[model samples]
Target: MSFIGIKKNITQKDTAEKYIGDVSTYISNNYSNNIKVHDIAKYVNITGAYLFRLFKEYLHTSPQQFLINFRMEKACELLKDCNFTTGQLARSIGYRDVLLFSKIFKKSFGISPSDYRKQL
Candidate 1:
């Protein structure tokens, strides 16, 4: 490729990386809120479909999956150190329904959050 073509490729790669980083940072900063894929796309100035593609290409996961994983990871950290009830823990991690949160926790870690805490 020509120098100009190489430069363009680098710039495109950089922009793609920046968008992914922006999405990740936004999720990390707002995982405690009831945020959605559309909200995240808006924050990053992209369409939701594009956001999905970006995450799928770069992270090998859907954006929604990434968000869920992020929330679950954060929940694990909080559960380790905080004396939060299940409901409180759910809300703290952006889950309004304790049952749903528990379900996801069980799916992710093969145990309920309470059980996970008990083990901890």
Candidate 2:
């Protein structure tokens, strides 16, 4: 009785789950770039639909929402520096348009970036 086949099956399952971490690392490293779900899926060699389902199953959110959360968190960290202008902060987190960044930031934290910085 050999257990090698069972171990191989477990290894394959682990490899499948590895894609989630891979996608997260890719997002973290390149969150500054204008990356889309498709880009992330391509990195994991999966379809965008599969990536979405994977995220939903594992992380309880879609990739797009996860990206938004990541960007907003980065914005919070950058907001700690009072010297950074809104436009600069926006660009740092892959948002080219300051207004859109402000909108999303406000939506996420219920405060404008400037006001958030002021609180800090």
Candidate 3:
């Protein structure tokens, strides 16, 4: 009696896989902009709540955490160019707040952006 034929048709594993793929693609494609969970979920025709649940159940993390890690990873790669300042790098990875970017960056790498560039 379900709209999608049956409730059993949509297993957690299937939903998790679909969510992961959609989120990964959306982030990879729009990491330079202000992306959000609601936007990605809407794009994939799913509810934001479902996206959060799938991310927590399968990935063991929230969408926001995943996005932060993804952005930090991208920022590290971009750092190799040695042409961007902390603010520039932060903005480059879709973060407008340099303080927040520095906090997240230190949390991920155990070093501040200035210290990171000094090491390079």
Per-structure clash totals for the candidates? 0, 0, 0
> Per-residue lDDT of 1-120 in model 2, one digit per residue for the tens?
259988997786686579889998999999998888899999989999988887887788999999999999999988885478999889989989899999999999999998998888
Rank candidates by TM-score, best first.
1, 2, 3
Ten-residue segment with the worst summed lDDT in candidate 1?
Answer: 50-59
Q: What TM-score against the true fold does each predicted structure earn?
A: 0.94, 0.86, 0.84
**Where does candidate 2 clash, by residue pair?**
none
lDDT of 1 by residue, 7-114 (tens): 998998898899999998999899999999999999999999998988888789999999999999999999999998989989999999899999999999999998
Alpha carbon lDDT at 74, candidate 3: 86
Which wins on lDDT, candidate 1 or candidate 3? 1
Q: Which residue pairs of candidate 1 clash?
A: none
Per-residue alpha-carbon lDDT of model 3 for 14-106, expressed as tens digits?
Answer: 867976997899889998898887888888889988888888888899988899999988888888775888899999899989999999999
Segments in model 2 whose C-alpha atoms lie over 4 Å from true places: 1-13
Clash number for candidate 3:
0
RMSD of 1: 1.1
